[model samples]
Target: MTTRTSHVDTFARDRLPPPQWQPEFLFELPELQFPDRLNCATELLDRWVAQGQGERLCLQAPGGVRWTYADLQDRANRIAHVLVREMGLVPGNRVLLRAPNNPMMAACWFAVMKAGGIAVATMPLLRAKELGQIIDKAQVSHALCDAALAAELQLAAAQHPVLREIRYFHEETPQGLEAAMARQSPSFDNVHTAADDICLIAFTSGTTGVPKGTMHFHRDVMAVCACWPRHVLKARADDVFIGSPPLAFTFGLGGLLLFPMSIGACSVLLDKASPPMLLEAIPRFGATVLFTAPTSYRAMAAQAGQLRIGAPRGGSLRKCVSAGEALPVATRALWKEHTGIEMIDGIGSTEMLHIFISADEAHARPGATGTVVPGYQACVLDDEGRPVPPGTLGRLAVKGPTGCRYLADERQRQYVQHGWNLTGDAYIVDEDGYFHYQSRTDDLIVSAGYNIAAVEVEDCLLQHPAVAECGVIGVPDEQRGQIVKAFVVLREGHVPSQAMVRELQDFAKRTVAPYKYPRAIEFREQLPRTETGKLQQFKLRSV
Candidate 1:
């Protein structure tokens, strides 16, 4: 790929991994082809208006505020003017965006991309210390945050000298970005950026708790849309997308904003999307596609009565996607039973940009994570980075147009090896070519010379009626080197007692291998989880 003239100095491009370490990119698919000079915002947002789709609805907010493609394009252009003329934002300069899933957040994201600036969107729940770390690590110079959620960023900016300017939006005050944007021109030209220009820097937490910045290019954004939504998702232009994952998360960024807009479709944004809120929003907005995690799906399945009001009657919700973590077989079955929709289980990460392994409704299996997405190649590799035989558990390695490019992080070498991105997942591929997720490589527990996948054990425990949530880990034991220990959160009516523990153990034995049953069971009010709702197994291990 040829590097085009970047308006601002390309800090992220300069920090990319060495050429040899980069994965082999594939753009042979007609949909993946792009021009040398391209602006993603122009393609995703502006083109819809230029092509006579301006009147089409683009965004639906919880407050009943709707935006057409023309409205979204005008706001994005005005925000771009604010970034360049008022905020002194230069191309390639990193802009930290902190907001929930709303129209303004989506507009600001496109504005940053339109102005040739890299967007570093953070979750609203991140604390001051975490925000400070991201600000320092990304060398962020400016921020566009929701005025309601600006407290933590204010505290973070106080400590980080690199964060020179902070602008609040969604506020009626004169100092807010929204007010500033209103005064600027609503017509601005998109920056002529290279197809490979870094447009986003997504931060993800590692096992050590430090955040790693994953740099993605404008082409990558378009690549994921072409590969996943075009082939697997197969969403129509009339589809209405809605989801619970925060827009800061890549999963939500793609599903809620990018993918929907790529096809001229619309999306409904909810600032607070709990399970109940999601259930209520579906029929309220006439949502056709849903994106969220498996845990949320499981909770909604348990409360099926609440979902019936806006449920799957008349094919209102044609698709349901589950990601962020592995979708347990039990959760998938329960959700399918409740909604008559087979939950599409996918596995994507900040490093990979979006879902590269998934199946449509037809090819989906109960427990399998589907085949490698089009334009990507995946394989199960052994310790030496060589492909393992079918059905043998090993590291999951994938290579495609989009791959890991850590921003000046040493872990880059560990993540990408020999031109293949080594996803830190333990998986087994069956003869039919479906990937079965066993566990994260770090989550595998070994006890008495047996390698036990914590996910398998947790799945078994989840089948018991008393278990609401569970985390399994290997704890030191004098007798067996290590023993499987389960920290469980019981349902509302269930009592945590010795009898319940015995019953859970017996249930696990009947569900999975006897050796995989939890030797020690500890009940908890709730399991430790990250802001993104992933189980923090390391925290459970310490307990």
Candidate 2:
């Protein structure tokens, strides 16, 4: 376990422009402290909106539009009034928000929180079929959506009558916000909400099958902001959080919205954050901290010099965090190679609400996920629930303030054993106390009477220069029960050949246990990933 900080730059000969002076460094925030009484609704964000109402730069979109903390609170207050007085919505009702990363969407989210309604936010790209399932599961009645995407909801609503009325809010609305803003009062009273009151019902992108709605309390939302954003990133009032993850995903909700608001910091939301869009947005917004997945980091790093994106401008972006999937060691090294900053990788699940374990730059182990976050405890348990010893792999179980409580589903028993939420991941802890992720329990590959971790093989394949992205799984083999199968995406200019396949197969064999080598390989343009950048192994398993 090596943890040292130094500045090193790596760029190819064709990548550099002459030296344009090094950037200055900004002072970082103090170490984190957990709050005793945490609640996302009236306790955390609304309190900040009241105390820091006059702060000018609070929220901004990719278009350079800005809003003060007061502006956001005023709009959210007005929206809350519309929901209560006009729509006849009452406290504890479920109101669905379906929109892109727009200002109104942010306003609606906090407004829903302010009115003591549970907000169920769906991604903008969700189709009718997927949309209907969530609407049905959450029993959502009134949906707030961007006017541009409301027609899709209209079609979805026709299928599910539970979603009777769809409300539209857009920054571009011609009638203006006078009616919308005037509909609510800024002096609205805070509805008394218990800490256990359900504040959100977020659907997990079940890569395996139907999405599961993970119920979270208002306290859990703020609990995550206090534990994760505080301990790992230590976001300050001045830090500007930026990310490519969608707010629909808990990863984005915590990193982009809740975390920033908890600290009175600002956030930059990009409606469409592709590699190129992020390249332009990060520097243009003067983003101080970045939250994205490993895949995006790899893609961004590959083009860093060409796009001029990774360089710190105005000492912004002191921290870069990656989640949603294992951060490839090569990608982490490559990102540090380019930016002179370590890429912090963490594991989080919707059931837990946000990241429970992550590596801070100061405490990072390159290939290993960081130790369990404070206020959380983890154990590796065997099938019989006995704890496994160090250096041995087993199911990862965790117990903490934030735990899984499935929405109207009995499957909760299958995941939560005793007080520990059995995170579906398999991992091994070394004698040194560092934990290394092996693979998801369902993703473990068994071939030729041997157990193999798909992640170990994939991580090895990622080290190969020609391999850009890859997925490893166990495929049915007549002779060997199951065999390793690899789905690879090659680098832009590199073509896969028979020799290249053999070379990658050989590389895995040498880098890992012999049984873990991929006996079969297929080249593809891209590996399927969730909106949060989690690899869809189920999609690969189907093929």
Which candidate number has the best lDDT?
1
Error of 1 at 401 (Å): 0.8
Write down the lDDT of every candidate, Cα atoms only: 0.85, 0.73
In the range 1-543, model 1's lDDT, one tens digit per residue, is 486557575777788888877777777788888888888998899899999989999999987799999999999899999999998988999999999889999999999999999999998767676788899898999899999988888988999988987889878899988789879998998889998899999987654446789999998998998998899999999999999877888899999999999999999999988888988888889899999877678778756544653235454788999887777788788887877788788988789999999999899998899999999999999999999999899999998889999999888888889888888889999999999988767754545434466776787788888889998887876434467899999999999899998999888775554667899999999888999999998898776
Question: How far out, in Å, is residue 487 in model 1?
Answer: 12
Worst 10 residues of 1 by lDDT: 304-313
Across 112-176, the per-residue lDDT of candidate 2 in tens digits comes to: 87777878998776667667878887778778888777766887899999776567876355343
> What RMSD value applies to candidate 2?
15.4
Clashing pairs in 2: 288-317
TM-scores of all models? 0.83, 0.75
Quote the lDDT for 412 in model 2. 70
| TM-score of candidate 2 to 2 decimals | 0.75
